[model samples]
Target chain A: MSQHPDSPARSNSGSHCGRVWVIAMHAFTQLVRMKVFYFLAVFAVIAIGSNFFDLPQHTGPEVSGIAVLSSIKSWSLGTMTLFSVVLGIVATALLLPKDVEDRTLYTILAKPVPRVDYLAGKLLGVLLLVFVSLALMDVLMSAVLQIRSSMILNQQMDFAQGRGWSAAEIASLRGDILSQGANASLQGAVFAVFLRASIMASLALLISTFSSSTLFTSIISFLIYFIGHFQADARAIFLESGAAGTGPVTRAISLVVSLVLPDFQLFNVIDAVIEGQAMPLLILAKLTAIGLFYAVFYVIASWFIFAEKEF
Target chain B: MLLAGAVRLPLEASLTGELRAAGLLPAPLAIGTRDHIGQTSSAVALGGLRTLVATFLNLRAYTFFTECRWDDVAGTFDTIVELAPHTIYYWETGAWHQAFNASSYYLNDSNLPSLRRDAAWRASVLNGRAFLERGIRNNPGDPKLNAYLGFLLTDHYKSRAFRDADATFLAASEAYRIAADGRDALPFLRRFQLYALARVPSREAEALALARELYQNRANHTVTMQCVYFSLESHANRSLIDPGSFAVSVFGSAQQAYATLTHYWLRGSEHLPVHGVASALRVLEAQLGIPADKSVFLQHPAQDAEDE
Candidate 1:
């Protein structure tokens, strides 16, 4: 709450963190002021309303009330996630540019707030907003899951009791409806995905800090997102094993290419999560660490560059 | 009789006597064939991935959301990936439908086995192989896909399964390695390094070297957060481990699903063979996780992650 610089009593280490916190809060409030959040809220509501019949047409006799509810819930969360990401990318990219455009940043910079402090504050604001959006969607999804899973369990019991059951029925019915929850890899993957998105956002922020044009930052950031994700595919091609198909130059090129881009593929564990696959915590922690490392790397890089700009 | 089951009118589905009289479509097509959401709102927009093809949703279409159609949808699969390609659930399931959604019972099943067995199989394998090969071109850092492509290759192109298949699989294994290597954290790279070094001429030594370094710089308190189900003891799960969909041999390392098919054909690893037609059924069931018993599958909402 209070920035007490060089406080020997509490350790002078992160006295600046107090300022960062305050700035982050300020940026978040601005996002609300810009009405981007309202736009997202409206989109989320539309997503929920768009679903026609919950049961997929191709499913045939498989249609059940529980299935309809699940599909709708999934659609709603998906829509929310989609809108949030779009908003995040659009909103965060505006960080540097908006300040430059309206001459708002020059005024802010006139105050005691240093450039690093400003950058960190903007990033924190974005990260917090992203977290809140994700959390809101998670709550919505988890609620639907809990309800659907419970209903399924109930219906299964009713079906078994009322119509009677076979040995196969007893075996298939596991207590945990999310059979994938049984696996560690899946759960780890979901966490990794979250962390990965954060890293992507941080990278976007770094680029935004330098570029005064919102269009350039968004385009480059989007390209980076594509390259980062597809980097895995690139390495797979150039580095095909052994001495048989490829030559030394190809291998050299592959090695160089691999190092250049972020491998966003590692963060992909959505299949594992949906399939009820096990996701070990170590996997999640490892991914989180990687994501944080990248995020920090970008932050420091951006700070170094931002500290230099003539404006 | 089938018409009688759902709709009250015997001859009054989408095709009806009027539309068929104009010769627009053949007799007795589902209302979906005529773009009627059948019983729901708008042909339900045929939601769900096309069987084994990975289709992306066009974000640009969001601007023209009302006019978007299956054919008009730009980069539909891109939309899906943009939403969140990391979710294997969405990728795997969406891809399966993209590549294999039996788009036509429209073709005569009676004419299938005898009529076009070799041709169809060849066509399927070629497309599958192409998908993997394309991934090999567009995305090479992804190691899992190479193995997945390898898995598909071994299944489709078993002729290449020579005496030194390990060397070949190693090529495919590179996908996993690059994916691992991309991490700022070295454990991911080291894990694959184990799998890589395992095949080295001097196995024990390579493993020993990698192991010692990894153990010394432990993740400390953050170790517990690594796995999703940190509580679970083992590292692999059936869903995550096998992930047997899109694994036919011909597609080798090529992730032939919605966003990008034939994820890895360049590495050329052996793929698993799920050859039965019922295997298609299994693809629909397991990969999609659509329980044959719809009720259970339906009970679970689709991805609630806001994005996949």
Candidate 2:
């Protein structure tokens, strides 16, 4: 098998890292040209629009403008989750089929390049697209949140001072407003969004290795994505079913489902963060570990299935 | 696949438990709550967009509010809080709608007969109180929710909905105390607690102790505090004390004491205790040499007087 002149394998640099980087960058540029970043405009509109939700529903100055801060976080993070997951799954699903159609896969695989690096590069490219997209959305969210939070803080301060609120009271109010605004936890939540998407992308990559078409891969990945949220519940039923005197068949089914599906509920700390709860660093680190664990396993799994596949 | 799941399942379960312990993951959705949120929202919320679905439902609740659909408004908030239980806004707004908006709507705008209207108003107020209490349970030690509970319990019109005046005041004081105990709570919460405690007949001694502590800070020497302090002190020393002298001792001067007591004496609608206030005023009037017909009591006699 002769390699194409433009292939990374034909170059003098035979390093796996170098080849993966080249392939990943190429994949990133290709996806970027698909205009995936256009979703940021919609996210901007959502983030900016969330400000108007600071409804007059508040009873007093202490709670005023708080609803709007929550609105911003909820809308922004929700949009980011939707965009990242769709981008992760769809972009990864399309890569293999597109490459095969373009004859790029044959050109790359016909050379000395290992299948694992090719697969890793393509997965990394999808992840890079998702990461870059989430980072930009995070920036937009934080900026809008900061500006609105400052306005709310100023308004609340003036009101507190006018009412002769104590210094402690003023500080407490400031703390509440700032908590709802952009902060470290919100960033952790955005990262959690990336983590969840990364899992989906890697899973899609594994599926696409044996998938007959991009449509099948995308559909199956989405079905799994939705079902993954319920994995924890299945585990709970299985674990507790013995004490509750459950039937063996039911217990077996629950156990099978629990062991087979990824428990996406662990990443749902994003909901709590949106509601003004802080995400601790240790938890975020643990979540990062889970994400990497899934991605690495899925990529290796993909490589195994793709290794001997015929063109 | 089974081996992989076996390894990750326990890890995922442990992380879920830890996240929940840290208040980072909300409890699983109850079936009733899921049913209430409907299909699309249930899907959205279950997909980890709970807060976003909550925001959308809140908008729907606003529509329910404008349409004068009070039941729908309350139901919508019930689901909203379930979706985002940690959100103070949802809790606060839910309570406000039931207690203030829905109750007021029943009182003033409902087409029901007067008797049914009154019952609806009272039920709405109680529902609001229940919602706030639930919020307090979900967010234990939260100052704002506790304070809101105190405010609801002490609200003049709403308090009437609660059957027992003494129990209502006692609960209000307890709520206010919790709020006041929180770090960085507003100064006035302590005073409000004192005000509520003073009305609880069995808690007069405790109220007096709190009042004395608050009095040590001169910032708490507002007219209501002075009036409440005087009444509590007078009650404690009822046997040996002369009202005129005690009033002078607490309020600094005959005229000042007389003016403050007279003002407090007339605010009967507020449900503040008036222990020994009438006697103090009678003694002060005699000393001030005000004629019987021209006396403060004769000029504006207490309506629904609560003399002790």
Candidate 3:
């Protein structure tokens, strides 16, 4: 069994990974040159601007410094969600048609590369761009949040000490303030954002495989993104719709849609984490597993449709 | 495609179950709220910016607040908190709007008849309290909301909203105690607990014990704390405690004791037990050479302390 130095199985696996990497890097470079990273500058401005929104007009004594931290997180994460999903879909949607128009698709497909590799490489590329962009935005957000949180903590500490807060009370106040600041949970939230975008990129790739135009792919992907949130509801209804006395035809339709659609709401853990709830590592693992599950399914699905298609 | 779908259906089901059990996903947006937020926002909210939608709703709620649309304010906050249940600010701000601002508006609205205004004001206060209680249920470990609840319940000017003065003070004291139980609760919160406890007629003994514990540290000897300490001791023990000597010892001087005790004496709405306040004031007035007409005795004690 060990006699062969090079086997076709080993060669195929190695070449598949290598080809995917090459195409992925190429896609990354293409998207990067599009000036997509400019959004980080806008994100920087937003992360900084959210610090000054000391709304409610009255910063009462009971108002801890956590409110501003919460705002910073909400605004920054919200912006990241918008940017990542849009980039995921649009970048991925553009990759196939643009490559075909540039004849890169034919040039690559003329080689030994599989369509799965081509699609996966393109998706990985869009994801890489999204991951880098989100990472930069996360850095800006974490830094802004760190500086602002420290300033607020100092002000709160002064206020607490002036009012003769106990050591325990001061410690507790510090804990509460720090909870809303940059931490592991916040990082997890950023990762969750990336996971969501990754799924979107793969879904867009699936759409782009058969889509007539980039606009059609983008529109359909966006529509699916929105509808994906309701997939859970549809699934729930389909599950209970039978027992709940709903018509069989409607239940059958819901079941079909639910089976077809990805449940985007599963990634809404970002909202929970931003609201200061700790996301257990197990939940993140489950989310990542599901994300991978979808990405793999969609990529394979794209390859299925694209495998025998003409230019 | 069919095989992939077959494999994914069960996996997605189990993942959804785990996520739902983990409380990561919120309930679906109500159709009414969806219509209100409009199609674009509904799309964004459903696309995972529920919190951003909530933040925008907060701003809209603020506008409603400024316009004095109390029902709209309440409705918007209801939707906002539902979207971001763990956000303390929305809960607190919403409760405050209902209890204080909305209630105040109802009280002074010239268009409403007096009787209707009274009912509306009472309803607003009750609604605000219910909202805060709901927030507490959502976030039981939060000290600020607990302290806010205590402040709202025990507010002297707002006492007309509650039926039972003593029971209300007891509830307030309990809320303050819970807030103070948090390791980060300010030192004043501990004394604030004693203040609320002092007003509870049946809790004087417990309040006295806490006051004594706080009094050991010279730093806890604020004027109110001193007055509460003197009042609780007098209320607990009928004899052997000379009010003047106790006040002087707590306040550190005869003139300061008189001034502080006299101020405490006049705050009738505060519900702090008069306890030895009057007796201490009488002795202080005699020693200070104050005229009988200027004495604290002639000043009408607040009915709050007497009612308890």
Judging by lDDT against the true structure, name the best candidate: 2
Candidate 1 C-alpha error for residue B140, in Å: 25
Tens-digit lDDT track of model 2 for A1-311: 23344565555645677778778999999999988788778887877777665564535656678778887788888899988999999999999999999999998887677889899999999999999899888898899989999999999999999998778778888888888888898999999999999999999999999999999999999999989888889899998997989899989999999988788989899999998887889999999999999999999889899997999
Candidate 2 Cα errors over 4 Å, as ranges: A1-14, A52-62, B299-308
The sequence of per-residue lDDT tens digits that candidate 1 reaches over residues B244-273 is 342332123222321111111112232211
Q: What is candidate 1's TM-score for chain B alone?
A: 0.28
- Clash pairs, model 3 backbone: A168-B183, A169-B184, B268-B302
Best of the two (1, 3) by lDDT: 3
CA displacement after TM-score superposition, residue B255 of candidate 3 (Å): 3.9
Q: For candidate 3, lDDT tens digit of each residue in A1-311?
A: 22221346635677678778888999999988888788778877877778766664323674555676777788899999999999999999888899989998888777666778788888889989999999999998999899988998899999989998778778878888888889998998999999999999999998998999999999999999989899888888887885889898989888888878888888888998888889889888888888898889889889889997898
- lDDT pick, better of 2 and 3: 2
How well does each candidate superpose onto the true structure, as a TM-score?
0.49, 0.94, 0.88
Q: Candidate 1: lDDT of A150?
A: 61
Across residues A156-261, which tens digit of lDDT does each residue of candidate 1 receive? 6666656554444333443334442223443243344456567667777888877768898888876776566545544654545363577778766655545555
Worst 10-residue lDDT window for candidate 3 chain A reads A1-10
Full candidate order by TM-score, most accurate first: 2, 3, 1
- For model 1, state the Cα shift of residue A207 in Å: 1.3
Show the lowest summed lDDT stretch of 10 residues, model 1 chain A: A55-64
* Ranking of candidates on lDDT, top first: 2, 3, 1
Query: How are the candidates ranked when ordered by DockQ, highest leading?
Result: 2, 3, 1
